[model samples]
Target: MLAGLQNVTFEFGARTIVEDATWHIHPNERIGLIGYNGTGKSTLLKLFAGEYAPSAGTVERSRSTSIGYLHQDLLSFDTNESILQVALHAFDKAKKIERELEEITKKLEEHTTDELLHAYSEKLHEYEEAGGYTIEHRTEEVLQGLGFSNSDLKRPYREFSGGWRMRVLLAKMILQQPDLLLLDEPTNHLDLPSIEWLEKYLQHYKGAVIIVSHDKYFLNRMVKKIVELYQRELHIYNGNYDFYEVEKQQRVELQQRAFENQQDYIRQQERFVERFKAKASKAAQAQSIQKRLDKLDRIEDVTIERPNIKINFNVDKTPGRVLVELKHVSKHFKNIDILEDASAEIDRGDKIALIGANGKGKSTLLRILAGAEPFEGERKWGHNVDDAFYAQHQLEALNINNTILDEMKEAGSKKTELELRTLLGCFLFSGDDADKKIKVLSGGEKARVALAKTMISKANFLLLDEPTNHLDIHSNELLIDALNRYQGSLILVSHDRYFISKTANKIWEIVDKKIKVFKGTYEEWVEWKERAESRNQTLASGSAPVKEVIKETPKASSNGQPTTSTGGANAPINKEAQKELQKQQKMFQQLEKQLADLNKQKAELEAELSNPSTYADPEAFKKTENAYRQVKDKLASVNADYEKVFEKIMTLEEQQS
Candidate 1:
């Protein structure tokens, strides 16, 4: 283990955050630390990072292990230093070795003594092993991977924004290659590409990783284990986020059953003891029963009561067919064009996801549509469209001096006090929590309150910008479900892939200063992009495009009568083209069938491998395991071919249409 907590307890004033928590950080383990806001997720990270000392028990770290922590807040750096210089600090040891090696080399040139030469040789070896020479290259690689341009590397640390500074710190941490890496929401400020890069980096990371993230997709991709802090205790799940969900539910059910059974047995024993103790003849029997009852290990119900957030978007009226239309809209800031002639139309029932890299004007477009900002060109709303917008910075608009109830009341004046209180309760503010000052709430809590306001807006169209920024996985799922059920049209700008996939039926991608509309889900869009890229690559390599065939056929004349084929224009498609289309369709069907059969075989093999009886016989199990691996490999190959065939068929169909 790289680090561990030994019955550790932590508190803030009288409020206990973690109580008697014990956890181990194993080498090469990818662990995701998760919990609701204010449930001590960050505190647990700090405890592991040695930033906090436990009130009771001990925090242990292996002597050889080194820890690198990336806090949610950016760390202080030398203002005059460039980003490259700050990142190079991670190689302090290597730099020191280099300095020593230089000195030894100079001494050896002067004296040429045996002892001096030996020292010089050893120092050179250490310098090479420490990667002293290629540090600059490695630093640049990491910086660029984290979204830093070459210009950004030379810029002074003080010149970068808070978000960019966090990236620099993250780069340093990754460069350090510590035995244990503690990341707290590392992806919070990252764009889609940066996040994908970070995921790949962590996947190849040799050391242990403990990440605290609200991104379910990230957790599912990066973690092998999940450590959840709930009800002031640590609960370990030996799987990723999806596995944790399934395993946690199973564990809770089992615990609840055991608790109920124990309670039932205790109740029977209590009645027996009470009746026997009243009779003098059975006093000894009663005493024995009472002793047994006292000796029994009681199980406390481990069921966690999660606060409810009843989010229902109140659609006052259905919007017209066209909810919003952006015609040749252009947005610029400080003389730099963010969007140029971007155009898109949203219908009343359309669920559109606006996606792009950071600062690509996704939010700007939403703001313009919401009338919160101005654009150079036309941004029109259809008849009777009432729009409500939820921005990432909406929490900052809340009145800090007012209570939660007062704020909600101000936004939703028509809502009754009881109704408002009930709504606040759904957002996890109940009883006196509803009366608490907004200034005292956490970021996540503030977000919930802002969302509560949006929900009560009763608008026919919703424009949401990063609405899931501060939400936990559960809250995200809840919000996704709500959005799926919302009758009003939605235009969302988010980097959350899972959320986009689940809620969006159309995609509005902002790329190269233009908004490209795709009529499909996020996953389909991704697949289409991949195919497009592959096709582009083939074209770049001088591959010929597929040829379209035409044949002369009877066509309608001006009088709407069929004209002779010899004199009429050719039809859109010919018999040969139809035959080719049918053949392609048959190929697609055949590939799909093969894929399904392979998947079924793979599943059956997996079932056999998981069966206890299969494992009881080692020889049989080994043979079945090998067969399963072969089937899995074959299935993967078939899936790839299936995707290619599907893409080809789609291309052919599009041409035919």
Candidate 2:
């Protein structure tokens, strides 16, 4: 075990976080620490990390166990050195040895001695053993994997924002390679690509990891166990988040039955005591039965607390078929080209998820669509379109002196106070919480107020950017449910894959400075992408595809054209094997495209030879004949390569089968 709690009871003032909780952190364990907002999940982590002592019992850790903790608090780190230097601090022993070696070398240059030589040799060996030479390369690799550019590595660390700094610290901790890693909302600062990169890196990590996050999709993919904190107790589930959900529900059902059965027995015992207490013959027996009943262990009724709210978005008017249209859009920052000649259409009822890596212009595109950012493009809104954009500006405009209820009323949703209060409840501002002034609320609370403000807007079309940023798992679910029921057309940017999967009916990706639209759900998009990748085709092809392979819905097993290089593979093949097949298939497609081009050239050459004007000049006629021969020769070579690739593909399929 790396570290754990042994019958530990922890409390914060009057509220108890956990009572007599025992949990073991085994080596190589991937655990997801989960709970509702304000349920003491963070406090439990502090207890396990030894930042807080248990009120009773003990916290256990091995004598040599090393822990690497990543949290929001790490943002306080300040440094003027380059990010590369900061991350290289992980190689402490190696760095010290390097300094000593440098000093010894300088002295040896002045005057040589046997003792100095021996010391220099020993230090050099030590440095090599500590991997001093490759530390910089490894640091740069990790930083780049966390979405840092090569230029950014040489910049001062203090110049970066909190999000970027958090990434640097994460990279450093990753390089440290501790026995266990405790990450609190690690993905909150990461973009889609960085999150995916982190997932892949952690999959092969040797140390144990405990993650506290509200991203259900992340938990389902990364965790092997779930440790839930509820009502001052720890419940362990030996499976992923999805498995825990089913197992927990079954457990609740069984507990409910047990409680009901116990209630029946108690009721019968009470009735017996009441009936016979007055009778002299049975008075003593009744007293004895009452004593036994009083000493019996009673099962408490089970009640699960989940956030519930009604997000009824009232679209005042329906827009035309084409809600918005973009024509020849061009956007750039300095020399970086975000979009150029990008054209896209947002039709009515199209729930689009704009997803990509950081610096791919996701938020910038949202601003462009909202007409808040100036770009060289034409943005046309359809008839009766009423759009409202919600982003960081909403929170920035909040009135700190105003109460939360006042802010909701001033939002102009035209809803009654009861409705507003119920909506606030979903944001975890229940009952008297609505009366609190915005000044007293935490940053998270203020952000929730801003979200509630946006939710109450009467826009027929909504553009939300990272709406689930500060939401807990339950609140995230409530918000997802609300977006699903909303009648208005919407476009949202979120890193939460589950949120996008549940709410988006269409997917939009900005690839190579253009919008690539996929007419399907997020799951369908993933399936399509995998299929395209397996066939050696990029979703964002530079030129036209052999054919458009997209269908209305990919889940129903639809096939489009079923042609080579344009069909989705319905058969389940091993992913690694599919990659090999895809390479061969890609070569075949390229050869086919090449063959088509060659055939077109050959046809043109034949047409040129038939021209009467060519014979008028003997030199031109001779040049045309040579060009035709060259085309034929090239076509033959390409055809041979195509045939070889086709055979290879067939052999691979047979072997895989």
lDDT (Cα atoms) of all candidates against the true structure: 0.79, 0.83
- Candidate 1, run of 10 with poorest lDDT: 557-566
Q: What is the lDDT of candidate 1?
A: 0.79
* Candidate 1 clash figure, as a count: 1
The per-candidate count of clashes, in order, stands at: 1, 0
TM-score of each: 0.79, 0.81
Model 1 residue 12 CA deviation in Å: 2.4
Q: How many backbone clashes does candidate 2 have?
A: 0
Candidate 2: residue 344 Cα off by (Å): 0.7
For model 2, the superposed segments whose C-alpha errors exceed 4 Å read 105-121, 536-657
Candidate 2, run of 10 with poorest lDDT: 557-566
Q: List the residue pairs that clash in candidate 1.
A: 309-426
